[model samples]
Target: MGRSPCCDKVGLKKGPWTPEEDQKLLAYIEEHGHGSWRALPAKAGLERCGKSCRLRWTNYLRPDIKRGKFSMQEEQTIIQLHALLGNRWSAIATHLPKRTDNEIKNYWNTHLKKRLDKMGIDPVTHKPKNDAILSNEGHSKSASNLSHMAQWESARLEAEARLVRESKLRTSHSSSPSLQHSLIGTSASSSSSSAPVLPSSTRYLDHAWNNGSSTSTVATRMSDLESPTSTLSENNVPPIMTSVIEFVGSSERGMVKEEGEREWNKGFQESTTHLGEYKDGMENSMPFTSSLHELTVTMATTWGSSTTSAHAHGHVSEDGFTNLLLNSNSDHRSLSSEGGGDSNNNCHGNSSDGGNGTGNELYEDNKIYWNNILNLMNCSSPSDSPMF
Candidate 1:
């Protein structure tokens, strides 16, 4: 079959939209959403084609669209994301909430591109002009790593976009007109102009590390934007999300994977602050695959029984998953391994527990196991990231 045109262009307005046109488009969308962008113009009483109406609304009239100059942080993010993503503007736009892909494309063409040229940097490769002289092996290795990370990020963004698209569809059908208007209004006003408010699907991704919505030290559950009473949540639409681990005091202390497991376990046991308790409310937060969910349950049970000392010392670590994995009494096994029968030996084989040779081997194995899990969570898995 041949491709279809976005909209019939005949006899439709093509010039810049006036204030009245913008108001009409915004009001209609705020009330009914731009449900079927191909049909929005006729319903909204605009003379423009649906394609024009969609572009107008998304690029300019949308309440959440941030207007005017980009900040330094945003510029750095754009440059970094561009270096990784090349010219995939929509993918880059996912990282930069509220900023349109069109705006980013334009800004790059006009400003950032010139700035890089002046500095003798190749905008395409995001490298210095003389980078050709650098060692091929080093450059290739770095490029390979960057490409891998970019692929991982790109796949994740696509998944999030798909889930959000589905959620929006369900929301459009279920939400009342009055509720939709209030949601866009609250979303527009409540967010401090500096902070980005993630769309509903972002709850599937790690909010702090990926989205960075909140500035407060305490990492809270999906904000008012995810509240059931909010516009998006009208009619009891379950948060069509599965991830979003909260990272409290994440910036204050860096997570060092190389640290001895026993040492870190001690620190976790001694810490007074308790955070990320998985309660009934969190039943829907993770919604892991059935196998992984069962594994989590097993791990959590083992950790609970063994953490009597942790309770005596005070509170535990920041998150339930962290606490479980960090303090599990059973021997650590790779996630690929199903049953725990063979790997019953503790990874934290203390010097006194097994003397020198065996203890060192177990210790090394423990580090590798932790590294593998951490890398898997942060890189391989799309649904979760290490939250600490």
Candidate 2:
């Protein structure tokens, strides 16, 4: 016989949870302690499906459920973990102390995903959408840079492992006097005598062990270099290793710079397209720069100070930033340039509409632009390329 439905189909409440229904479910679970969700509704005298009861309790009414907004730290953790683990919401919830997988999934769908979309980032891949543009400009640069970094980290890890193995071997050999004597050639004639002759293998092993130790030290220094909190104390990281990390950081910065430039250009093109089709009344009334700048400043200030701001401004800024980039100046190039170059200049100058009817069209096109960018960036290598 097949398994039955979780609860009887007749006369059960379905949609939103009512107070009386919540009381019945909560009272039943509180007293009886909820053994099996599939069997709970019938036993509890609740007119709801067991699955509904379970979802209601788990997602909404659970005593430990954190009902408010997620903090900035939580948002960052979610983003980073999502980048690493994809849509395994249940798995992601494990790292989060008081959150449910369902809640996380909903938040990502309603909030985080939209935010990433607006920011020209691929929600799935967590990479800049302009990767193709960067690549087309003959920048195999970031890939090579990341590859070299991975090599250095790999080498360091390997060297540390080798050192540990050699240390174990030496400790074992030294612990057994018979083996030590045989290996070192310590004779009875040298009883009270000086140093024993070390075997060639033993000498080589000692040298290997020392080299491994040195390599581990270099690796630690590299790690410190990569960390933002690291400071130059009286005892700084070794100069040679610092140089290596600096080189890697420089390459990574170049890649970021290239990606930023492409994003700014894409934003500008999108804005221009909108400006062209803008209606006379709308264009005249459009306080483009002031409105977007106020939005951006408000969002930045809000998010910079509060945990709940993550949920509030998360999606808003992505859309706002893109729009701001668009309606701003034509000369707003080189987003990652030092000393607040064209970006600041554009931000200050491009506050008024250029009397074009493109604003509404630009807003409509924003969604499509982000979707296309996301699709392109999320493509898994060349064989699955969307454009091709």
Candidate 3:
């Protein structure tokens, strides 16, 4: 079959569209409207191809195009849309009426995506890009999924921490109470030890996650997070998200803040007090992913054996946080291994603890072994659960 007509570069000029070319294209469209983009270039007396002409008109010369710095509202829309749709700029552009897909794509690549990376977030998954999380997944399906969600939560905290630092800097220079208030998101009367809550958009992502919404639904919820003001109030932040955010987002990130001010030579005691204690043991290990899924399961399951369960699998770190270390580091093997795919296949022939065990007991032991390590973190929910 012949190549698609669109891709065939026959005799069309392909390069920057000059002012004269733009004028000719614009004049043709203005006089008789853009009938068909593929045929419009030829009719407009331009040497450019249809794709080039279409891009030039839509991105630059369109009568409805809004040319200037993007307002905060537009920015939020773009962030929310990009989160839901990934790189589908054309679809993202439909809701953003005066903007072109090309414009939104460029803005994302040049701006928001970069900021997310600086904040330790993976722009594609909207999750943390830490190798520890990926390596920890190993080959277990349940552990892998939980670890992925944990990664998302971690990424969120990381981004929020950056925002808090930025907000602190912004507040230091400007006396605008309202701008400061919006950025702070919580009352000054709140406990100084409390972590700063996430922005409305972050909270919205959490909401979408909790509800198990699809991409389309995620886009819809993004619209609900909108407000006439660029800065959303703390009232808009959900309690579940805030309770967790205040802890994880504030503590470790404080270490970075203190380092950013090292010229003063602040002591460790002063840093912990100004921030929160960095008791990042196994559970507090990275201050993010270690305890999420496991803790959530613990809170949702039986609670009477919490202490016994803790002792069964994990050890206590110096900081007193249970360093479960994602099922005590036994669930995962390094994916880099040649036989990483089935690391345990040979183990099926081995006998049980007593060596003379029958098949029934071995079956139950196998079942329990794979269910999960020990799940007895004493807490009420993901936010309140004891670290790891």
Candidate 4:
């Protein structure tokens, strides 16, 4: 099939918009409305092509556009959404209420992209050079870990989808009495009562995970195990272990029991000093034991037994899990790998435990990671450069 021309070859202006053209277009749009762009230029007495007029109004002339510099928060949101959505500028723009896709695309290309490059990050992958260096430190070990994590994530997602479908099917069948009657009453009742309702939108996962919504409970549990630590050490010890210990010690009796005793003594002295008010208040006070018990239970569920921990971590098929983790490591390696001949050069630098130069490389890699995060956090202003 032949493609159509963007605009007619007749006498129509096609460069930057002039003030006169803007005024005529704006006045015409305000009074008569822009019902059709192709017909708009002639109706408004402008020489410009309809496309040019439309682009001018939508990008530059729109009253709702925020013309000033972008804020830090706005920049961060853009970076994060961009990471997830890639170069879908229009989609990203929709999330930023007062921004246009053209403006965002320009800013990312000129400003944010350059900044990330200077910081030693791949603007496209959002990763550092050392990732490849570390990956090459050990072939089999890193690959295995990468594969395991991937399979785990895949299995978890599959389980979640299955649960959702099952819930939906049960809900549909329950709502239809003839369908339910085809089955035994006991079976129908159990299915209807057990099936949970899912939210209307997939984006609702954010609120669901944070607030412990029914639909998100399984996913949230998995997330807690897989992502318990914000920062993993080079030694491979989970950060959540320390957090759990601190929480246990603090809530139960303070890390040092002496501190707890001292606080109790101080409270007693204060009560004696204000005897009249203290007696009334003290009568209604409950023991802190119950709160401590709840905390202990939560901690146990979060990190204690191996079986529950595995369940909470969610399942991953061996092959998919291996592929996921390997891909992450591959992403790192691909960025660091210089050429076909450089494989030996890359492998000789570090060890898997990072005991050699691997730790230093990982630390450097982490620095680049943080820098990208910071840049993303501060990337709000629209760039003056042309969009890709």
Candidate 5:
């Protein structure tokens, strides 16, 4: 004979548990502690099946259950657990005392996961989406120096992709001084409208580990057209690709506070007419500069889940970009004279798909394609950043 179902009888209740059912389950558990969930509902006089009773009790009826918004602490824990457990929500739920497996699963699908995407973090690989496309050549010893540089370039490409998507939508309307002001006005308004939406603060990532023992910062060397002395609501579509690389160390944080912070804040404050005025070489020469080495990034569109495919591979059809020639024949160099390497001076980034796509359509297509690059440098990026 076939094995009996857990709830073989018909008309067992399911779906959202009712308050009276919740009360019955709670009262029964309190009076005669539920030793076996499979037999609890019938003994407790509940119409719900064993499965539904177990779910209701574990997910909602429990006295200690914590509901409402998940705290950042809880979010971090869930992310770390999910990374280890994969889709084993029940196993993952063990660590979260008050949260049920279903609640955790829902949060992962609906909330925490989306935040990771917006920051260009791959929820699965726990790295940047661009890292997987790397070939053996991109990981060679000589070419490793360019890895972090490649990450920043990839992020810039993704950011530019956002601009491209937004600009196309903003077309047909002219960008005037007053109009630009108005665009900036309702930035925090709602999700329904497009342009004037501020770029995410993932522009720089500073990851501090073990109580400031070591710090890694990845700063995107924004192109002249992409800087804060600009406005994005303009009708013009900026170049699809540009590259600049910078590494910030912990020691330099004080320097930035004293010197660079002022200039950084000034650029955002001094918004001007960006009528294609940001010439290509405005930040010295293309592909490399005196202060920072430029890596010319070339991108290709992979099969993706984005809303727009018009320029999924970007306007540039070429596979390789010149002048990004990173012929690093030298061995690994250190920032300090001592044996210690400059953790801060290294480019900090990750490889993988973003986690925070949500209802937005450009979730998968937004990944940066580094035609041939691997993770040569370990940029321990801690948090996503915007210009702020």
Candidate 6:
């Protein structure tokens, strides 16, 4: 069956409403709420259709509706909300209290849309025109890696959130001794009757324990409070390890001795012989900066030997950057012991006292380039960022 029109078109008066008609509609609605717009026209004693009457009341005649030019704040609010919600004007209207969806739509079309277009923003996407153009470029390998990391972080957060909710639920369930005991009994019986099931937080820990030979990759470093776990896979996705690792690392590890602790002990204990040498090597390892300094010097020396350069001896050489970093440490010690003034800084050569402007510029550009690479490398590890 076809849906009926809001009101019959034959007898209805439409378009601009007269002042007399507006008064009649407003008076009726004020006395009794505008219930069922289909029936409102007859009850309000107006020739206008119910849809027209409803629009007039909601858009203009409503006492709460703010009629005036949109303020700077309101315009900004509309633009932001439009970006999020798109053409759903009714949804946007909810956020901008006292404004009608119709009014906002008109304002955006007549004013804001043209302004944003002039400023090189895509009104629909609310992003720069240049960004939109660049976005059309296909995803790179680095983009794929970033997406994988993002998915992992999202899953970790979601699992942690679920664990919190369950913890709260458990706390509430434990408040009544009888209920707690009953629930425990039921869970025990069910587990004993069938295969034992684990909580989502503990499931990954169990998987890690059982799968002893699974290799662990360090995506993130361990905190002071917790030791990092070996990664376990189910369908090749890393399992939720955050809460389980925290629980195991905390004082609560002692409580799970019968179940989790035994499996955890047995799993890692079997690999101790193979890991012993690695552990010893770690204990004897140099600090990261010292290790990096040595690596950089070795790499630069090799690179300089392999490649040809036209630069003069005093200018920044291929190996000069490595030497610069190496000298910085020695200079720090020298500055501490002797006066800071007399040391001949080989890093800058004569560039320190305003000689070799071109060399200084080249050095600065190289410095910035290397610093950007180092920053990108640092960002690859989740442990470095607080957001992760």
Identify the candidate with maximal lDDT.
Answer: 1
lDDT of 1 by residue, 1-388 (tens): 8867655567687788999999899888877877778888899999988889888877877666777776654565566557546897876675555678899999999987887676555788755455345424423433443453344344445444444455555555677865544333212122233333334545433443344323221112333223222232222211211121222111011122333434433432222011111112222121111112222323333433434433433323335344454434123332112233233333222112111222223323333333333332333223333443
How many residue pairs clash in model 5? 20
TM-score for model 4? 0.40
Flag the better candidate by lDDT, 4 or 6: 6
- Candidate 4 residue runs with Cα over 4 Å from true position: 132-388
In model 2, state the lDDT of residue 35: 56
TM-score of each: 0.50, 0.36, 0.38, 0.40, 0.36, 0.38
lDDT of 4 by residue, 95-210 (tens): 45457779889988987677656645456644343333433324343333333332332333333334333554455555553332222111112233333223122223323322
Q: Using TM-score as the measure, which candidate wins?
A: 1
The sequence of per-residue lDDT tens digits that candidate 5 reaches over residues 116-182 is: 5764556764444443353233223213433333343333433433443344236314544333323
- Predictions in order: lDDT: 0.45, 0.41, 0.40, 0.39, 0.35, 0.41
Q: Any residue pairs clashing in model 6, and if so which?
A: none
Whole-model alpha-carbon lDDT for candidate 1? 0.45
What global local distance difference test value does model 2 have? 0.41
After superposition, candidate 6 runs with Cα above 4 Å error: 137-388
Model 2 clash pairs are 274-358, 275-358, 277-357, 277-358, 278-357, 278-358, 279-357
lDDT of 2 by residue, 21-80 (tens): 899887776665555787888898887888998888868776655656765444544564
Candidate 3 per-residue lDDT, tens place, 1-388, comes to 8757773667788778889998998778666555567888778888777888777876888665656665544554455445434575754554354577788889889976886577565677544456235433222332343443343334333344344345544553464433332232211111244542433444454454444334234434433433333243334333322222222222211111113223222321221121121122122222122222224322212111222343232322222222333232222212111122233322211111111212232223322322222211111113422343
Q: Backbone collision count in every prediction?
A: 0, 7, 1, 12, 20, 0
